[model samples]
Target: MKKVIISLFALVAGTGFAVAEDAGCEAFKWPVTREQALFAAAPATPSGGTLAVGAAADLALVPVDKAAFAVPPEHAPGEGTFGAVASVAVPPEGAIQISLSGEAWIDVIQDGKAVKSAGYSGVKTCPGIRKSVRFKLAAGPATIQFSGAKKAELKVAVLTPE
Candidate 1:
């Protein structure tokens, strides 16, 4: 009985010491200087739309008829799904940024399949600033889409590997 108890104690102690640990990744070192830090910041990509010169135009102009604007009844509000468009191409190493005028649920699709999805609730008034999401795509091109009941306008931008 004494030997069995001692063996159990030793096994428990050994198992505790073998737990997983988080190692600081040296490859992801922080910025050394303020200038370098600023440079290291992620760069924003241009929207795939026309450039505006003055105060921004109203975003909610009906691009299509009301029936056309209606989302498919089956599509739920959440991440990883879009009511319009089929696929998005994401670079293998960078991320994608989307600008919206209202709240939305965004979905990410890759290689003709749904990879993941996320919901982004409203922050402020309509035509809010852009929200960026980073996704590592060692696999291939990715497609992202946004769908929600809110009448938000949206534009998409893609960032590629340097």
Candidate 2:
């Protein structure tokens, strides 16, 4: 009986530790500088639309439509699974800055391939916080996709290093 009790306690402790560690934001590397440019503020309509952006137009404001994506039961208010695509043109190889209205999982796709992504266990309880990710991107066309935001409508912005 003593051995069984000890083993059970150890298993439970280990599980708790694992969950804690997995809850962190490890998939996306946060940007060093919070610099970004504000572009357009629009709604991420049901039939998603693509916006043409240049290095000059780094930041964009688009409200997320919660009804567009699947929301899990445990999802917090202002949090839902949503996706928006943006077409960007980079003059030269440089860094891309992406900021979302709330906690979000981001994916950067270029040439039909995913170049970057972010993963988190649960919704980030950031009501007005703008979570951002910066990545090195090649010069050309790239698509930025955002999902798992903590709000029904979110502001999506993009920036390229000057």
Candidate 3:
């Protein structure tokens, strides 16, 4: 009994796996705040499918917290940008594809810098509605950073070679 109790305690403490504390739309029983709404917009992976983000409404230059949208920085030199850190182990020559959505702009970043940026303007079923980009991985794992969106929601996915 003592050993079992200690093992259970150790398991929870050792690994950082905890129940999904962030209540999804339930916590805010009544009036919902912008922050709450924004977080809720995050996309969830289905049973079997590629991962990506989604937006609920048309996002403008300024994003209302809790609103489902992608983050797009402005056109300024150091303006529109998003931050993401990735270091995946690659065997040899490999490539990956990144998909994004929302009313904001997004840039594909690697190694703490922006490699490619795509401007996303919303039109009815037109090109800017939702966008995607692809990048060929280098020899090893690489870090990526994205930025430059005025007020848009964004999502990213990494597709490895099969």
Candidate 4:
């Protein structure tokens, strides 16, 4: 019985002897199933884009030089990187979530100042999205800036928390 239980744990743990972790979308620390679903149905948005609540956007980013940010990014991208500046409507609850499909620097700016992140979770092994950051916003318009992305294209989802 002891050996059987140990074998079961190893299999579930993906110890490499029998199974391995695929590290799928379900692996994030917090559930991002909705964001994952949004990515599939999202449409591309240009640099001066507006992402509605509960929707995703395949952000059509540009070279760092042309991102035209309202306030400069905290982490400026070196040559050959990509970025985008977009807006999202914050709900009255003042809590919002932003999810990304790849690695990049995220800045949420409101009222001409950068908004600090309240919570963040990321999973490198997940394929479609890399991180999700939450913020307590002012329940109005907010600017989201992305910089230092390896590619000129990154998928993003902006939504109110569930």
Candidate with best lDDT = 4
Off by over 4 Å in 1: 1-75, 78-82, 117-122, 125-127, 160-162
What digit string (tens of lDDT, one per residue) describes model 4 on residues 1-162? Answer: 999999998777766533225655556667898988989988988988898888899998899889998898887788899999998888889899899999889999999999899989887767798999999989889999999999878899987876
Global lDDT for candidate 2? 0.50
Candidate 3 Cα misplacement greater than 4 A, ranges: 1-91, 103-129
**Model 1 / residue 55 / CA error / Å:** 19
Per-residue accuracy of model 1 over 1-162 as CA lDDT, tens digit each:
999999999999877654422211111222112222222332332222221211122232222223132233234654332233323444444344333333444555555455442322222321233333344444445444445525534433333312
TM-score of 3: 0.36
Estimate, for each residue in 2-65, the C-alpha lDDT of model 2 and write its tens digit.
Answer: 9999999999999987876674443234431232224243334332445443322223323455
Worst 10 residues of 1 by lDDT: 23-32
| Higher-scoring candidate on TM-score, 1 or 2 | 2
Candidates in order, TM-scores: namely 0.38, 0.48, 0.36, 0.84
Q: Count the backbone clashes (under 3 Å) in each candidate.
A: 10, 8, 24, 0
Whole-model lDDT for model 4 versus the true structure? 0.87
